[model samples]
Target chain A: MLPGGSTSVTTSMYSDGMSTSDRLIESTRELLWERGYVGTSPKAILERAGAGQGSMYHHFKGKPDLALAAIRRTAEELRASAEGALGGPGTPYERIEAYLRRERDVLRGCPIGRLTMDPDVVASDELRAPVDETIDWIRERIAGIVEEGKEQGQFAATLDGEEIAATVLATVQGGYVLARASGSPAAFDTGVRGLLSLLAPHSS
Target chain B: MLPGGSTSVTTSMYSDGMSTSDRLIESTRELLWERGYVGTSPKAILERAGAGQGSMYHHFKGKPDLALAAIRRTAEELRASAEGALGGPGTPYERIEAYLRRERDVLRGCPIGRLTMDPDVVASDELRAPVDETIDWIRERIAGIVEEGKEQGQFAATLDGEEIAATVLATVQGGYVLARASGSPAAFDTGVRGLLSLLAPHSS
Candidate 1:
């Protein structure tokens, strides 16, 4: 509704109840994931969104502006979904396990994590911020839970929360790489189970 | 040399001692790491290699052909470097620690692992074989070490060799993602150290 949708009545852009801007953002997100920033063209976004030629110009300043919006949207969604497990009802290890075991499109890879490999995204400060912040936020959030686990005597007293949190984050981001390389999620699954095994409390 | 570099001249391609084919392959490897398969153009490869228009044509069939050669080179280099540690003198855990602690260009990420994220590479079986094989070989190699440790009574017999191997691979791959996203190598180092801590042998 915010993207000046009122100007286009003769040639509608929206496919359904969603606004023109919303469709554009969604389309851009998908393209960014599949084709990356350099390969994702303005024409592709318009065609994918089913919007007319000038619809993109009306909705956003340009590709960068639109891409920024899409990236932020993706970042927010990832954080929220991760919180579903991290902030859920369970012990710290159990919550971490749940996050690891949560459903994912492993083959498609992490939409945000993959962006780091895109030189265009990594080179631009604006483009890189969301990816950096999201990964950092996840690490910090995980560290907090790990700290709670330590404080409650649920984990080894020597386990460094920040370090363990980084391991968890890397396991997930790297899991996608392994899974994608092999054309199977088995690597990702085994990695998670292995980390869980290592994190399991020792019996006295 | 295998690419018919002998035919090249004043329309010259070589900058120094290296043959035109070697330069082309080397250039393709760097570009693929920096720009990815889809973003890396033939023109870019030629320019970086300091070769003439017909240089790439003579050396390799085309972009895909050159890319395959480059990918194989990178894969082979990676395996050799990893083997330096995995096959080194140490206990099973010590050898693994050596591999994890090996110096790497963390911010640049793993050259072979990054290829998996390239849609073009993932889509092509010929282009993808080296990446898949390299990853599988490393995983299997690590699993063998884990199995070795279990056999020697150095590790708990219950540990799954394959699962732990996957965890090691994921940590390195995902560690790159974290390091690049944050614009520093600290995350990568922390993740490795964290894993080492977890893997430190228990004192009886």
Candidate 2:
């Protein structure tokens, strides 16, 4: 058997088998979500990660570098989550409905929407590119499905796929703003339901 | 007629006929658009408004008070602008279309959306209340028009006026976020067009 003290130390040092970089990234993501770019301090990140200062500095040159990693990770997770809703074997209307109905903490706002409001996040191309790309991907993905539905006669012949896709995305993001502003989830639900009703007649 | 130097100095101060408070609010509104709440300093507001420290302090107690005044001014301006679009004598569909088509510098983002993203703004009731009221007023104003449309047989029999009103407001706000994120006005146009198309059938 391994030495008890060494094994315990090993477990403490590398719990969950997350590498040093992953731990740093995870911590940065949480901090970014909580305090935003301007409010989060490096000391806070290190404290949350349970990592030493050297390890963090070694992994990332500075806050900007750490933020880039976090933004990319968030983008990827958003895309994957969306794909899970949009890629199933169903009519385009079904897919759209499923995506809209996906559970969300409306009060917290969309992670991507939060970034749009951030001056620091919007000022840097390094931070904004992932956000732009992720949203573009989502809109394109939805538009493609809508286009497919149009070709298959699942939607009205006059439906504008690209425009509808933009509307769908806008409704959800805008819904979050309304919910946050009113301090209630009802506004968000109302917006989503309105969008769904708009799509209902087109569903086969 | 008055003493030359003293008259000149007093005239210079009142030349524009704008009050110091007005100047301060205008300056804070622009700064809030650019720097958000945390990034904007009291000094920045004073300098931008060309008001001296003594004048600023004499007019307002402190930053929060100044910000509250600025926020209220912004709310009033926003309501006035929206009323220009929503209060006109037209079909509900026409009024909404006019509101949506109201020329906007879409990439700059909405003033209220910018405030919602600000942690400091969200934390203070004095700051948040005007934002809440302004958005609520816009939605209610639009909903009132929609209800009128229903009475006039301009909307489909089954349409939900409140839901559609929320959707319309959310779309515009979300469109701003999307456009700002992508650095393009295309998303905003697409969202507006899609909503207009949705409303078209009801117009007849």
TM-score, every prediction: 0.92, 0.87
Would you list the clashing residue pairs of candidate 2?
none
Off by over 4 Å in 2: A1-20, A51-55, A202-204, B1-19, B52-57, B202-204
Least accurate 10 contiguous residues by lDDT in model 2 chain A: A1-10
TM-score of 2: 0.87
RMSD of each: 5.6, 7.7
Q: Is the docking of candidate 1 incorrect, acceptable, medium or high quality?
A: medium
User: Which sections of candidate 1 miss by over 4 Å?
Assistant: A1-14, B1-15
Cα lDDT, model 1, residue B167: 93
lDDT of 1 at B30: 80
Residue A82, model 1: Cα distance from true site in angstroms: 0.1
Give the per-residue lDDT of model 1 (tens digit) for B38-98. Answer: 8888987777777889989897999999999999999999999999999999999999999
Cα lDDT, model 1, residue A86: 94
Q: Which candidate is the best by lDDT?
A: 1
TM-score of chain A of each: 0.91, 0.87
